[model samples]
Target: MGTINTTTNERFFVDYRITLNDGQDIKKIAQEICIEQTVEIPEDCVPQTHWDYGITGIVEDIIPSDKIKNQVLVSISYHCDISSYSVPQLLNTLFGNISLKNNIRIDNLRVPQSFSQLLPGPRWGIDGIREKLDVFNRPLTCTALKPVGLSSTELASMASQFATGGADIIKDDHGITNQPFAKFEDRVQRVQAAINEANAKSGTKTIYCPMLNDEPDLMKKQVDFCLKSGIEGALAAPMLIGCGAFVSLRRQTDLILMAHPAFAGTFFHSNLHGATPAFLLGRFFRLIGADISIFPNAGGRFSFTQEECNELSDALRMPDNNILPAFPAPAGGMRIERVSEMYEKYGKDTVFIIGGNLQQLSDDLSVATGLFLEAVRNCACATKEIL
Candidate 1:
């Protein structure tokens, strides 16, 4: 077991460093870390909320290490016996806010002898999602309902058709906002209603994730609204808003969260300073309670390679031996035509989201949707039988 100082009671501390942008100061960074103990959780674990599961750890130390870039290094010690909790849970409680809040990096975790046995990662992982989705032999198909300029009725209607036509998860385009023509509340209620209608008639429980990107308070409201209306998940971009926002939302709600890749491009773009996408998006997001994280698949609009995509999938699906696994959703320029090949490449633990291709299939929404659905079902079933 890894011990900090072999002297007395094993104390668990987080050795971290924070780097500020140009013109930033240590005092400003210190103030950001100056927080009191704010315990988060619910009265009943079943009715849990996001704010209830996390703690507010303040910056305890600051260093002037020239070796490190615009960074701050600090160590946080926790006294509670964490032997009962899993590693993912411990990490979530410790540095869940690293990327979302101020510029901070968790260089190392000093686990005490008492809690060293806890495994840190997904339990069922990618294999589990495939089992749940029942697509083991091939890649999964995914799509998005985008260009949030349409009205609630339009969006809901599209959702209904998409569910009927066979898209696995009809997510909102990340760019969609709560505009006048298509308000968030009205759109969510209508789209959820449409999805419910489709599910009842088709015997398929398709998920409808609303783009719940707003201010902190409004974001919470959006989540609450989705839950009340029976929405399955939410489309959120952590970098654009904050990962802490999603963490808080997950603690409060019980819906699966599909993380979007927006401002996150900046982190993975760099080589030396920033964190890796697989570690941050695949591993950390799961720890922070994201059920499904959306990323740019290789050969799509973004530049992530096939190897990078596979590595990310492995990270997300890898068995944690301790924690629940989150699903890996590959979006950005995905299509239904390549469903089979994508499945073959990505394996079973994937939500292959097709966004723009759905729009180009045909003007007749119903026919286009039907074609897409047929392809997905055929591919998914064929893959399953082969497996």
Candidate 2:
């Protein structure tokens, strides 16, 4: 039998393709379909679309075919199961059941952002992280120790210097990998040691969140290594690995969890389909346990507008959300001059990541690092007073 009984304020479209193990009465199956939808959609958003056609209501009329309803799709809004699963898993379960013979897929999930708003955000937002680090006066300063091609020693040396120069967080370049020249395990060890040494000497609480985007099985091992090595957080690209990967990793491990926005371009391109920037990067990333969600900032390498970026920031911190509040690490075309502007506009809930521009600014990374830190600090302090 299909699921019955919808919940209140829940809305979702359940598209299932029913395939019988044997065969059942088509009429019985249709009735079961209504029941299944009821089970999926919460009560509130129901009856509203119950009688409407296409997206709303049930399959009032149908002709059973020999093959499954591959072309057929159902639209439903149920009391979304915001209790247990991550956003993606919720999506999967919402469409997991139902006779595929009748329902094929769940297409057009509108305002998943609305549903996301119902989830928890990051644990520590931008200002929150800065406060945790005792960095009150600036956009929290950060940098990557990189050129993935560099040796472990070379990488470690650079990271130590960045830490010494006041880099709040020094991360492995997202491109760094387990290559023989600079294996993930060895490089992480060296870089972490360097940062730790710098902290010991300078009394600065710099953190190192290694990039751990590897095969699923290998991914967990690497995360374990980072933690065992005393690394504070990690960088995982959900787009490159897949959304559930992040949630699964976060659930199993205890890392600060910084999300990188790689391979997520397709969804934001269309206004009508897929998900919005704030939904995927801001709302969803936090739900899955990202302490910091990085995206392409405006006037940078990518083309997100100021409005889109602002909405993303708001989505990251909507008070009603239960998700941990994550820092909005805006990168791409960010530079020294715009640090003050970004801190003012986005407020303290941001981590301004300046990459190649930092390199371009000064040959001496330490000097460049200090300048970056000072710039964000000035902005943070100024913004705090105004607020």
Candidate 3:
């Protein structure tokens, strides 16, 4: 069965693909989502104006899935005002209550491009980041100060080597924070100095972006400290710090923000349910201030399919909607040998994060980092000739 939606100027859309594994009825489930998503009261209890004014969710269609066997897709839309010009509330309207139910997943989500700014997308997008590094027509190289046990000085040494080796940006591993071995402030100061010293020697604009993960106020404080240390960018975990808090941080600073995919696995682990990577890591992450969105690459240690990675890249670099394109950094147990393959898949506007591979290559990280950069520069699939 299908429901037709008359053109109404005030509605945004959500496409939820669900499986009726337990003999679930199409009309019943569609109505349930419409009510559960907005105007939670009983059908009889809803006011007349809500119906007349298009304030309630209207199921646009219920069609069988073409790919996944026995699964179906339902398109439900809500009034634009229902979001209340808020991120959390828009999320609520999309899946707040239904998230608790089974047999559901968000296949696609869209708001009018005109209203995208209410969510505060990336501050320094793809072009802005390229401008910062002064590297163009090629994929950017990024690394992390990792393995947590390293003291601030040791991590700083790694940062200096990366900068000297022609790395475009160096960031903190998501695991590193205010640990006793390497406290946040101490690590930030030393790494900034190391990168600065390397830049001075090399005359390159390699940037140092520290990790900021704490309470909102504390994250703001860390930002202030980075600014004092002359740091140009920082990594953040939005899933850990709440989306609302992440948006607040974007409004508060102009620092280039890279989003780490920590704790996001819970949202998309099952084929039967949860959000897709394109929506969460690509579109939604861009909406909430991630200039560079990092995710597990397909052939890496994680299980992200190549299709998911392609969809995510499309979502980030798709048509303008009051938001800018974000660079997708494919990491997680990545190897440097696949540089050409990754470049072919993601193209020029991508960040290749090779951490463990760099360590595995050699004892001298400076040389290993240079080799990583050279691989990207020497990729045969890239469009531009070597400069």
Candidate 4:
């Protein structure tokens, strides 16, 4: 029952693709979302003045889907101020309540230019990270110090080996938080020490990025600890810590932020519901300041398809007025043997993360990582222009 003030143009729009099963009416569901997402009142009882001000969500139109059967795209418009220009509020306004609904997915969205600039997305995006590693014109290489349960000394030794082999980055696995087996401080310190020595010996610029988390205070403390030890980058699961907290860290520090997709699958797992993997992992994470966004590689260990990975890559690296391009890291059980294929897929503007395959190929981790480096640097599709 919401009426639009056609005179007012201060609004944003979202294209929601709704699947019409059981002969459901597209018009009713669109109106229902307008009511449910906004005023939370019965349509008949909605205040006249509120409608005059266009206070409730408004369905711009219902466009029949061209791609899928029984699917329709509803374009909804919301007053710009409703989101308060905050990343968290914008997301909540976009998908908070509707996320629980069946067969509704966010197909695409648009916000005003001013609104998009409220938060400076990605403190150190793809170019900044490439500068930090001093690797350019080729796919950058990264690996996680992983498998948990390892002592800090063991992980640090692993770090030294990877650094010696000239990998661009050696980061902590998302699971390697403040576990008692190798506490955050102890592990970060040891790993940095090992990488530092290796860099000194080999003249490589291998950055050590620890997984930072906990309360904001604790995360700041962790950053301080790492900064003092000459560490310049870190990783965190934005969904696990909340996107607002993640942005705060980006605005407050200079660390290159690597975003993990942990606990994010709940938001984009179903074909009939939730956000798309490209939207949540690539577009959303890039907007919230992920210098590098990591996802499970297609054909590696997860269910992501080639089309989905392409969408994700486009969302991250595509030029945008508001967001700088971020590195799309196709990771999670990735193998070194697929380096050439992955390079052809993701191209040079990517960060390839290969974990256990390095060890599986060689007893000497450095030799394994060296082979990884060689594989990536000499891929058939490559034309390196290191700067």
Q: At residue 178, what lDDT does model 4 achieve?
A: 89
Model 3 poorest 10 in a row by lDDT:
1-10
lDDT per residue, candidate 2, 23-42, as tens digits?
Answer: 55545554555645444464
Task: Give the C-alpha miss distance for residue 128 in model 2, angstroms.
Answer: 5.8
Residue-by-residue lDDT tens digits, candidate 4, 12-57: 8888889998878899999989888878889999989778787778
lDDT, model 4? 0.85
Model 3 clashes, total count: 0
User: Which parts of model 2 are misplaced by more than 4 Å?
Assistant: 1-76, 79-87, 93-128, 383-387
Name the runs in model 4 displaced over 4 angstroms: 1-9, 380-387
Question: TM-score for model 4?
Answer: 0.93
If candidate 3 were superposed on the true structure by all CA atoms, what would the RMSD be?
Answer: 3.8
TM-score of each: 0.68, 0.74, 0.94, 0.93
lDDT of 1 by residue, 45-139 (tens): 32223222223343556676565566666666554343224443555555554446655655444454444234323333456545544545544
Model 2 C-alpha RMSD to native? 9.5
Q: Please list the residue runs of candidate 3 whose C-alpha ends up more than 4 Å from where it truly belongs after superposition.
A: 1-9, 380-384
Give, for candidate 1, the lowest lDDT window spanning 10 residues.
Answer: 46-55
